[model samples]
Target: MEIIAPGDKFFHDIPEKIINDTRYMSYFKDCIGVIDGTHVDARIPVEEQAAYIGRYHSLTQNVIAACDFNMCFTFVSPGWEGSAHAVRIFKHAVMDPKYNFPAPPPVDAGYPLQRGYLRPYLGTRYHIPDFRRGHINAE
Candidate 1:
């Protein structure tokens, strides 16, 4: 609660910084970042284990974040879980009037669904990847 500065509280220029930086994972262009679930040890009471025990072994929180090729975190949802999804946290962080990133084209649009872009299948929409790759005919 006390570590984050007011400006760094949520999404910001971090995503754009990752998109432009070429020093890290060069495979991506216009890609904002990637995230994965990891487990960590906890000291909480046994009653709390049910909520924390993640996919494989022990207690954990589902962390969803976007990091640049340089391993710098651009956007991060620190404490999240199976009850919620990564896309939901990212969307929540950005939609707050503070971030002001361009809202994605409405979900009803045709290109995303047809190309299998950010559908429920590809996982959450937080993947700031350069999805434009190999997308010449998508228009």
Candidate 2:
């Protein structure tokens, strides 16, 4: 994992894609990567199947992963039961020292906010197409 995994140096600079794209260059200059979770089918013993069953009633494992803007994987944490919430897995990855998750840059580093991730507001129309069509109902 060490060979392919991103080191501290990888998080210090803006991605070339973001720098070149006018739409994201200014907004995402301080962003390092994106993180999310997905469920993958898993085979387990009958006794352990219950823990692995997800909303679809099938055995699966919830895998948390992070990737840079270039879509290259920087970190992956798999084997969590599918029943586990994504936030739970994400919290574990961030708090656990073994994961070696890269720390966010300092607030004084020109970021407007002191946050590691940015999430769109709930129930908001965030797509460019939606804005263009004038469907501006955000509530």
Candidate 3:
């Protein structure tokens, strides 16, 4: 904890910046950042290989990570079994008081329901590339 400074200052500071950014405000208005799980190849004893082999049939270790739009990693949880589900990892991280993961959006908003967590309203323009294209000439 001393190395990471797991406190309000360390956790809330970046969220504030993300909340204020125009490009990220609307779609992920209530979100601090995005969390995702990745897989990295690993080697283990053949007897234990089944536990490490992932859905893709490759030996892997699951790594869950959180990052902001700037691509800065704020949190990382690694070394889970490859078979471990991402949602399970996420739930554990948020529920554990040690991490103090950011609060999720209001439940009524119906987040994480098939929209890749949060989706822009239908017909609404989103994505940084779209923003860049529309504002290419703007100062």
Top candidate on TM-score is: 2
| lDDT string, candidate 3, 1-139, tens digits | 4222223433334465667888866655555566677889998888988888898899999998877655666678887889998877877876698875555444344334432246346655454446766644432
- Tell me the TM-score of model 1: 0.43
Cα lDDT tens digits, model 1, 1-139, are 3232223333244454545667743543333334443334555567665766665556667665554445765555566553345456555655586644333323332222332114333433433344544343432
The count of backbone overlaps in candidate 3 is 0
Deviation (Å) of 114 in candidate 2: 8.9
Pairs of residues clashing in candidate 3: none
- Which of 1 and 3 is ahead in lDDT? 3
Quote each prediction's TM-score.
Answer: 0.43, 0.77, 0.59
- Per-residue CA lDDT of model 2 for 1-139, tens digit only, reads 5533665544677789999999998888888887777889999999889999998899999998888887888888899998999878877877798887665665343212325566555567654556787656543
Alpha-carbon local distance difference test for all models? 0.46, 0.76, 0.66
Off by over 4 Å in 3: 1-24, 102-139
lDDT of 3 at 36: 71
Best by the lDDT measure: 2
Q: Considering lDDT, where higher is better, how would the candidates rank from best to worst?
A: 2, 3, 1
When summed lDDT is taken over every stretch of 10 residues in candidate 2, the lowest stretch is 106-115
